[model samples]
Target: MSDANKKAIRTAIQTGIGVAAALPMIVAASGVPAALPWVAGALAVAGGVARVMALPVVQALLPSWLRTDSSASRR
Candidate 1:
């Protein structure tokens, strides 16, 4: 509904898609021993969350010169 909520949902869906794509490779490369895939999946989800959460912090830390805005207000 709101922009913040929409952004969060978009981030989560993108992360889920990434995990879905990577999980099979992780399982195949590591050779699943029943619990290993589950463990890897958990770790992947955690990492994805951390990454998404860090985005705003990273943007804040970046120099203004390095940031870009396409809004008319920026012109």
Candidate 2:
């Protein structure tokens, strides 16, 4: 696989793990009826953003300044 594909997969897995970890807290907060819409909207937007960030095209287009390369930082 190409580097872009690997990066995309890594991004997706990281996002999935994050969403999984946050699921219980999100579920607990859903008990508030008035806050349900906002919670759902936030989840939808977050999911959309995660999905977008995982795309190869987006990965390639991302500015280098935003990247956090640990090896580079250590130098």
**Which candidate leads the pack in lDDT?**
2
Q: List candidate 1 stretches off by more than 4 Å.
A: 33-75
Residue-wise C-alpha lDDT for candidate 2, range 9-55, written one tens digit per residue:
99998787578557547767766543577766766666676677666
| Cα displacement (Å) at residue 70, model 2 | 20
* RMSD of every prediction: 10.6, 11.1
Write down the lDDT of every candidate, Cα atoms only: 0.62, 0.65
In the range 1-59, model 1's lDDT, one tens digit per residue, is 89999999989977775665566566668766536666766767756765653465554
Task: Point out where model 2 deviates above 4 Å.
Answer: 32-75
Clashing residue pairs for model 2: none
Local lDDT at 25 for model 1: 66
Candidate that scores best on TM-score: 2
